[model samples]
Target chain A: MAASNIDPAIFEQLQAKIDEEGRIKDELKDIIQQLEKQGRVTQSILSRIHNTPTGQLGPAVFQPCERSILTQIHLVKVLSDIASKHPFYKWNNLWTREMQNLIFCLQLRHWLAHQELETIEQVGNELGVPINVKDRDIFHLTIEEYLLALTNTIDELTRLAPNAVTLGDFSRPLQISKFIKDIHAGFQLLNLKNDTLRRRSDGIKYAVKKVEDVVYDLSLRGLLPKQRSSDDTPAEAKGGAGAPASDMDSDVFLEG
Target chain B: MQMAGMKRSRDGPKPQGRADWDSPYIPMFENFRAELDEHHDRREKIIKASRDITASSKKIIFALQRVRNLGEKIPPPLIKSKEYSQHTSTIHERFVSVAPDLKGINAYRYQRQISPGIQEFMEAVLFRHYLETQSILSPSESAKLISENVLLTEDDYVLGLFDMTGELMRYAITQMATNGELPASRTGGRGNILTGLQDLRTKLEALDVSGSYGLSKNAEQKMSTTRTSVEKVENAVYSMTVRGKERPKGWNPGMDTSRPVGEVEG
Candidate 1:
């Protein structure tokens, strides 16, 4: 298709979305800056914890760690902002838990920075969480894993509040199905051996298939497209070989 | 020794073998030797001619390069001038004088001024040449093809463009981070970028327009995977940037601001 033939409405919408994304990214830049300042204090605290033995605690247990406190407050604020902006109907408990974990990390950083090593165990005990750095590799969690977790949490929330997440106005589910089929065809063409490529293709195909199935079910229930299989065929021919002809005719018409 | 002496005696000089040895057969023998030498030379010349033909044949006999550049490299002859008749006569004589066994001679000799067909052939050859030189299509060429032919809206075009741009940015950021010029961010934060892109894609799909631009299942999945790798690079950049912030001097949070937001407006 030529660029001249592009659907103007869709183009406009896409342009709007792109613009919105740019704005969000700018906002994130400012947020990252604020977070970085807090990150410094958190890093110091983490470093201290690293120095201390598992069971031992350092001195200076009562001093107020301004930076660490500020870091926790900043993190909570960010989490709240994200939750509010999230399109999901209900914010998942996982987000809250993640935020809490962040707070603990901040507090742990504070303990280390102030040389209040002895209080580390106490702080962990009070929070009912173990300070097993070796076992809990918080720092090692990859971004992909983190995003997967976040998306999964969002998915769960969407499931809980289906009405909150508005269904896309277009036939997105069908597009997704088509996309999956194309990807499968592409993979067959490339004949790649890389496991990563295979897995990626599989993942896309699965997501598209899922969306297709949902759309199909919705269409069957008259929640999506109103046209029914019986609407096109004669009642007597509905259950017989003639049914296929009706389907073919509809498909041909739709394509045209 | 006795046998040797007897042989010598038998073969004793016979009066110089007949005065001047001028028998009639003498002239015949000399003539025969001369003819034999001529035959040997002729055979050699024939062998040399055959070798020349074989060598020329082994090499490209036809000027393939000239044929390849027939229209573009060579100028077509002017046919309407006073020299037309003379030129035609010369061409005719050259054609008639060439080897009779040559194939496609008539077609070759009938060539006229360069036409559109010739131009197209030349273009195809040039295209093949470009392909050989470049080995693969350049990104710009790919983008041009996509923009001109792919059934997509301006939004889809822009989105695909940004997708490519984002990949480049991520690569740069990763390189910078590795060089210790940028900080890598925390893990979960990187997904925000992918999430943002995904949101845009989802929104685009939600539009009511028929046959909007979208990912193929394979492309979407590949995109997802690519997104993860990009996120990893983003994390590294964020980490480096955050780490850099710890240093009192040269810290500027605004430096990490994402740009071109206004330009993307619908």
Candidate 2:
């Protein structure tokens, strides 16, 4: 059947409602910008600590960055409240679609602050957001977005490997190599589609190779431990043994 | 691996489960996935409707073009014609059909997705209007003509006008090649496509539109293209008039004579 023209009053009302939605979207965008700015500052400050020696780095290195991340968390909480007032859950997956970068940065910071991945429940607990509330009623990062953020964090760690070797931190390279390899193994278990997650998972191998190269360079100069693992597999455990790169089980040291 | 769905009730009385705050069995948000599906469905409907509107609007432009040689009685502008009214009504009907689905979605948010169809429709409508009545359309009048609820923003309106100038350039060249009746200037001579184009340029230039957020640059680029189209029309008309004197008597410019019009000696 052919459609008819809408009633004038209903049309006007719809226009007004759409206008209100647009206004709210603009406000949300402004808040997102603030969150992004704070995230960048937190990243730069944390990067300073990543390069500095552990003993030389004072509490001051983490204090200001923690404050910045907390501010971002507060902004996210405020955005969550504002988003709940509208049907934002139905509105094009706005959390992941419009603010993927912002949320990824937040997750990266939260992961850096604590060595472990930041669980959704932990973030809600820290921010005083009710976890038991019905889904879609709360705005939290999805696991997929967290995994994407984890990929970015791994990329940052890979970049830090050469700096660690240059700064006479031989142990840091082994730690980073072991950490990233564990992440790569976890990614292998997942059946990711041909999207950001799969693309990022593909990048994990390059990070592993980069860290291995740093370790190899250090070991050539007689800087690496003779056998760091303390296992009977001396050939594979040594840093520059030139073991095959395609062994899938070689990096499966940490199981999620 | 546990990806929970997110959904919210749009309109209803508050559900009774709020009172049981300590109930160990909280229902999983199964309905949230339904909302995402609905959003996709709604977008599909609007896109289909916009396509229909674009097709019908093009037909209206063709119909308006049929009356190009009406010998001065073009029936009170083509927009007031039966063909124009019928086509515009259908466009409004399609727009109204999608109104319910787009309740909370700002039309501008999808402007990038949907504006091509709309701007093409605008080009057809504005071109017909300009052919019948030699005045350019204001943004407000365009908004009203489009529909009451749908806001044809100034940026889109100006962008549509930019395309309309291109169409007008083609129309002017065709009209001069066939009928040899030029677009009238204030001085009122036979060949005046240049005057009409100049008027349009002046009117568009007078608009205060520097702050239209990214649209300003597009409008500027299109404005230059519109000027080029106008120049093409002017050059075509200039050659036609200059070479017309060299043709023999009783020469119908519309006719496909044995020789090129420029080659025919007086």
Candidate 3:
């Protein structure tokens, strides 16, 4: 037999590397699965907002939600410890979704309480992780991931505005409308490529409109707590959710 | 759950009120827009560089395909040819330009974007390595040859080796047709290009990449093509052996033997 040019050791080394990476992924996945469970718990608790009165939300929603979020944060720390030893992006896909979910939960909770967007730094500080890390390879939250969380918050808040009205909190829709519209406006300023962020950000306009509809419904019935100096003129219904990009500008709402 | 598989749908339209310009989140999102825009710009640069690298690597392989012998240095004249130099430079330039974008934490971030170019470059590198050394190039050596800035994954190394087998099949068939023999080591070694290929086929087949996530899908895809390439060489060699006495000199062995034999023989 002719001498083999391939060294058997080479394939062995590669197998070893593959096995090692699989082990790391398995470990991370174990923790991520735990994280996913906690995320669901948090979401289930937060989803109570649709029916629960806003005053009761502190004990019924935020408290339990925060506890679940903290548990998720602990799991993230465990994941971060194990993952930091390897290339960040190499195994990042394994946990990016979970991270996005966890951060979205944080953003949602913060918005429900504070009525403003959660800063990435605040998220990093709360989660005990770095945000937008660029200097060296280590575990950190990415801007895209946080932005994804913001988009999630926008979607959640849109749902909340309509529900808040149903719960007899008629003024809540105005705050939500302004918040989402502002968020949508912020998204418009971005030079987004065709990616998840772009797609999620694209939904922001719809969210802006959804909250506007709630506000408009309230104003039409004179349920608005206070009328604005300018006429309470609502822009056309986003007209259609599928309205192209150009259709968004005309969907604008004027403060009553 | 809200973020999972967030698809952009045309939900029913809501009202667009005049946008609140003085958004409290503007400064924060502006920072995001700047950072995201920079990231996208960097990604675009890397992607552009990657495509250029792929193109240059393919051209290099085209130049390398002209070589008539193996297990020795590529002819200096061919290596120094202007066309070859241009392609080599282009590959280097493309790789160097995107090198920073792929550094440290960002290495694996742009991995998907840059992988095709790396794989194509690996194919060219492996082909050249085999043409000169008559052996498979190891990942470390490949890493050294590529650039210090780029990380060469084992998947790229193995996939490139698989494609290099196709180049070998072509090389063997062309050589056997022209010279009536397989190119083997002239230094009293038992190894010939066909034996080396068969060895690679067996070696690669034996590699346990099933556990690997990225490699499992891509390696499985390449395995069948690799198997066919090795088989083509085997068939060429078999035809040459069995028909050695009857076939006219310089006749090409192809899938259709009857029609082109005389044309090739003359």
Model 3 agreement with the true structure over B1-266: per-residue lDDT tens digits = 13211122212122233343366677887898889888888888888988998899999998998898778899999999999999999988888778878888888888888888999999999999888888777788889877678888887777777888888888888888777777876774648888888888888888888667788888887889989988988988888889766776676777335675445552
Candidate 2 local lDDT, A92-195, one digit each (tens): 25445424454445555554443335554565566555442323334555455546667777887787678755554455565566556556656655645456
How are the candidates ranked when ordered by lDDT, highest leading?
A: 3, 2, 1
**Can you list the residue pairs that collide in candidate 2?**
B6-B32, B7-B32
> For residues A131-150, could you state the per-residue lDDT of candidate 3 as single tens digits?
88889899999998898888
DockQ of each: 0.01, 0.04, 0.34
Task: After superposing candidate 2 on the true structure, give the runs of residues whose Cα lies further than 4 Å from its correct spot.
Answer: A1-40, A52-61, A70-102, A113-151, A157-256, B1-52, B69-90, B147-149, B183-194, B206-210, B240-266
Best lDDT goes to which candidate? Answer: 3
Each prediction's total of clashing residue pairs, residues at least 3 apart in sequence or on different chains, is: 22, 2, 11
iRMS per model in Å: 42.5, 18.8, 7.8
Find the 10 residues in a row with the least total lDDT in model 1 chain A.
A233-242
Candidate 1 versus the native: TM-score?
0.22
lDDT of 1 by residue, A193-225 (tens): 343433543454444344444544434433332
Evaluated at residue B108, the lDDT of candidate 1 is 20
Residue A152 Cα positional deviation in candidate 1, in Å, after optimal superposition: 22
Better of 1 and 2 by DockQ: 2
| lDDT per residue as tens, model 2, B152-206 | 6555666777788787776666666556555453334322445666666655565
